[model samples]
Target: MKSLITAPLLLISGFLFLTLAAARPQLNVLMISVDDLRDWTNFLGGYDGEVFTPHMDALAERGISFTNAHCPSPVCNPSRTSVMTGLMPSTTGIYSNSQWLRPNHPEATTLPQFFKDRGFKVVGSGKSFHHTAGNNPPDQWHDYFRFPWADFPWTRSNKLNYPWTEWQPPPPEYPFSKVEYLRGKDERDWGILPRKESKYDDVVIVDYAIDFLESHSGDPFFLSVGTFHPHLPWYIPKRFHDLYADSEIQLPVFPENDLDNIPPIPRKWAEARRDEMQAARDAGEWEEAVRCYLASISFADAQVGRVLEALENSHFAKSTIIVLWSDHGFHLGEKGHWMKSTLWEEATRVPFIIATPGMENSGQSSSRPVNLVSIFPTLVSLLSLESNTDFDGPDLTPLLANPDAEWSHPSLIDFGYGNTAVRNEHWRYIRYNDGTEELYDHQTDPNEWKNLADHPMYQKVKDNLAEYLPESYTENVPGKNAFVFDPENWTFTNKETGRVVHGRQ
Candidate 1:
């Protein structure tokens, strides 16, 4: 009887020890992406004096804010592609919005796909990829939500108000509310998306994300919530719009002769788009447009706050890693351009925040210039998961673990089809495929208002950054030109060569 009791006790004690030894804590990831969000806020304090993003300010207050974070490319598709695949836009050959990523890079491993392979339930909603909504791979998610913006009353009214208008607001067949701020203005006037009290698309995204958390109880999960506002025709709820009135809102300062030192191609491109911009300005639509953009950003922030709240309240809060990023930055009438297709800071610097469990209380900042491509490998290292072979970025786990640690590479930004720009600690170097270049000492010219490329005093600085440019980009690709719009016709393909050959190239 004594031997039997001793044996049972020993067995129980051994089991307990092993359980304690092998047990890994629960881990979850909350990745929130906002479209066209620029890093011109209180965090980096990039703006001359603007104070818009309060929720993002709070986020920066809680975690790490990458002062020099940038997209792989200035355009959406390539930027998002680089972000998801951990490959630079050049390596992936996804340079423009017209270029579809699926057929071209089918073999590429996506950020969420990697997590899914590790037994984590992954769910996505809104616009994570460029048009992933219409042509999403069924296997990408355990489940996904694609809510229609059609039911928005503002979208319905826009069509009626501007019958000849080429740009219509989203469709109005879906369920949402029309939250109005100003008394008598039509939905189009305010440029605000309609919303149902708590059922807005942004709100819905958070709702589903939190719901996933509840259902997955003990299992690890990866939730990616993409907010579509603050993109085009910047629309937001009325309450957000009222946050900035006409007089209170400041217009983007139009730099006098900003194009004076830029190259011919970029300068000419800006000039070509001048007519449409002037039309909007002449009609007093630009400021309203700017106000709408600011409001949309605030709207996106509120949605972000919801997700953060859920994470904090969940049991997995102590173990989860929260990352929020914008697909790429946008130009709100900067460089006489209103979109994201240039190497300018307005078009390249995106909002990046990473909040880890143990590091949650450690709010820090890094001006270390890292690309969005680094996200994949960093997550892999953070989770200590099985390593894979498909990656073109370095794991930034060391940097995040100790941001003050030394790094060898400067972050590269692929702007236009072949234009490349790199941000070092103190300088911004840009090189166009046509052999044109621009260099600016960010310390002296924070706005990049002056070009030091021609200045002989900083020749060494320029040479160092140039050496950092990848040779892959300098080498030519098949059926491609250095400065043409689309080197590879992404929409259509050639039968004989299996390459994109016809349309834009």
Candidate 2:
């Protein structure tokens, strides 16, 4: 009788053990980013012009592709700040590229910080932040490693070379040379190359990411690897450039009369950027720019492939969530915008593909307008994380489960202070604080050939989008904390309340 009782107890205990094992956290995350990568790549449904990114194509094929994902802002700093903190530019108070984000909100909980708080080993490297200057927060990362090939070489400065410039690395098998400089570190003009194989930022960053996986052996970890390429000076070794020729490359589709219908603000912006691109093309340097951009993208793609390959090769493939995205897209002379800071589709829209473990259906696509801000809540839902009310983004896991899930909110894009745009499936709407507005029907005008803001019929649609914008902004007001960073410049304060604005302010 005692033996029987013990056997039943033992069976119950075994069942409980299995239950715990199944319920225990066995998740890992790998978030990768590329700089100035637009939707022009063949993989992300970009037009087949001069570029081919097979690795990215493969990654997109295995993940849930968000065709209309956009950044909070067009510029790098604010956009990245939004992604990192999962907060809008108004709330975060990180309005521009020059402002240092951390000092403004020292107590704020970043995405990495949240994951790190949950006992996950968080590691970051490369251009994950806005400026790529200063040390990372301790709470956000348990370990941080800078990738070697991750940064640009200072020897190939665009400003230094001026008119006729081509950035080239050292010849054959002997990677780019590293030259250390202390004078202009924070200035955007400076670049740096890697020393040895181990020093290559991309190689080093990925190596450490894979190393983190091996070290944990089976534990969960969150690793963020940022690749800085395809940005400016389009610097890469000759081998990558050699892969393409002017004959094989097709120019971007920018019509001569492309600006007929666009709003004045956007038209002017695009025209300026287009001229810069035209100068490069006229100087017989368009192919060089294209080759370098594509090569850098391909190079970054190769690095990404390695990380994904490592996961598949390791035991973590079954439980890892791989998210690859660009902070914002770059322009290869499309829409007249050369390098972001515009509200056009090319500059605002980004490539967002997520390969979640255990998600059976692959190669799924969603037309829903989603913002990078949604990344926080999406991860929380996927990981079955503890509920928290602080996060503003809604869980997008349902979309992953059913690609046709019902999600109908227009994704919002922020420009400079008081400028905002809302993108829906059929229409794009914009409202500037100076009372300027723009509207475009994407179906009729994909290239924004016509601005329908003056049309009387679309008033309802414009009003609808305007309602989505915050009526009265709250939280991170510019002047309150901005002076800490830049004392000379006066930020936009609450005109009415005299106190810092609230609610998207």
Candidate 3:
């Protein structure tokens, strides 16, 4: 009789355990991606003047802000591919925007695919991946909208046939900034768009995200909402431009001899956009360009606010995890560069924040040097998913739990095949493909105005940071010139090797 009673009690306890486990809700992920956003927000304080970023600042308050986060690569295609696939550019050979991900790496499971495989409703809109035709495969998500500018009339009319094309026809007085160099070049131009903000691509993308948040109910979701603002052609609504007064706009500190200490490789990177910088300076439109960028950032912040408001109103708000990050940082006349693709502090340091449900250390900040490559594995850990050994980055759950955890790992930023930058808490060490190096002690030079790699005193420091560099870099895969891409069939045929690879439609 005693044995029978014991058996019944044990069965009841086991049933209760299973029931509790089954009733627990799975954590959903809301990934917000901002393209080419640097550390200029109100929180990061990378800028000198007032930058309107209330939404991003509030989001930082809700999570652990990684102040030292850097991209896996300093360019879009390579950096996004590395973040999504959990592989470094050095390992995948995806070192530039010209190379397509699917044609080169067919087997790597992307972050969304990892969740989708485990029964999550994956959806995305806007420039989540590189906003190119072949780079963002459809099968990665259950539903996705490509960089929405492709649907605009100006884009469809071939007036500007690029993904980052102007969303609408320029105002008749084009080059609104009155800079002659930007007259025909739409990519570099920035001005007030004489239209309603509702019609913009970033606004439309945020609307899609809001709709999904409101209506989503079934399986846990992995929703990616990407904003393509503050990227290029900073053309935005007039209201955003109104936020910044020209008198309040402060230009970045431009040292006349800033490039004198760097190696030849990065010197070339600085000179790459010198002509554009010169034109802006020559026209005295530098302040206007900075104002446009600030306005664009405010515009992007508004879009993020829309999505956050929708999520808060939805039922999934309490159960969801919010991860906001930029693909890579931008250089707005810093280091004498106008765009990304450099391995400098401005080009590599991005805005990274992860807000998990019921986080104990909320509103805290972490200065641990972390790479965006950790995003994939970090999400996998947060969701309690099976670990994959193929990830080159470590699980960042430890840092999430404790912002000041003992983390020795340095953030690695790769540019080209052999050009890499290792950034830890104190120093930034850059090694070019040709073996020339540049080292800056961040302790003394936060602006990186000086190079210390040539000094024997910092040789030990350089050696310590150099250990984090890639042991070997993979050779670059076939670029667009080496393959014929058939958009109709979604396939790439290598011209020389005759190898055919099918891409997801």
TM-score of each: 0.81, 0.80, 0.92
Q: CA lDDT of each candidate? A: 0.67, 0.65, 0.83
How many clashing pairs does model 1 include?
8
The segments of candidate 2 whose C-alpha lies over 4 angstroms from its true place after superposition are 1-24, 147-199, 260-264, 271-275, 387-389, 474-505
Could you tell me the lDDT of residue 385 within candidate 2?
64
TM-score of 2: 0.80
Instruction: Give the range of the ten consecutive residues with the poorest summed lDDT in model 2.
Output: 1-10
lDDT of 1 at 83: 79
C-alpha-based local distance difference test score of model 3: 0.83
- Top-TM-score structure, candidate number: 3
lDDT of 1: 0.67
Q: Which ten residues in a row have the lowest lDDT in candidate 1?
A: 1-10
lDDT of 3 by residue, 1-505 (tens): 0010111111111332233235555889999999889999998999988899999999999999999999999888999998888888888888888898787667667888888899999999998888777787677889997665732334333321253345566446667777898666646777887767888989999889999998888999999999999887788898889889644787788798998878888988888877887799899998888899889999999999999999999998788889999999888788888888899999999999999877778899999999889888777767656644367777787877778989989988889889999999999999999999999889889999998889999899988889988898888877877777766677878898889888664
Sorting all predicted structures by lDDT, with the top scorer first, yields: 3, 1, 2
On lDDT, the stronger of 2 and 3 is 3
| lDDT tens per residue, model 2, 55-84 | 778887888888878888888888887787
> Mind sharing the TM-score for model 1?
0.81
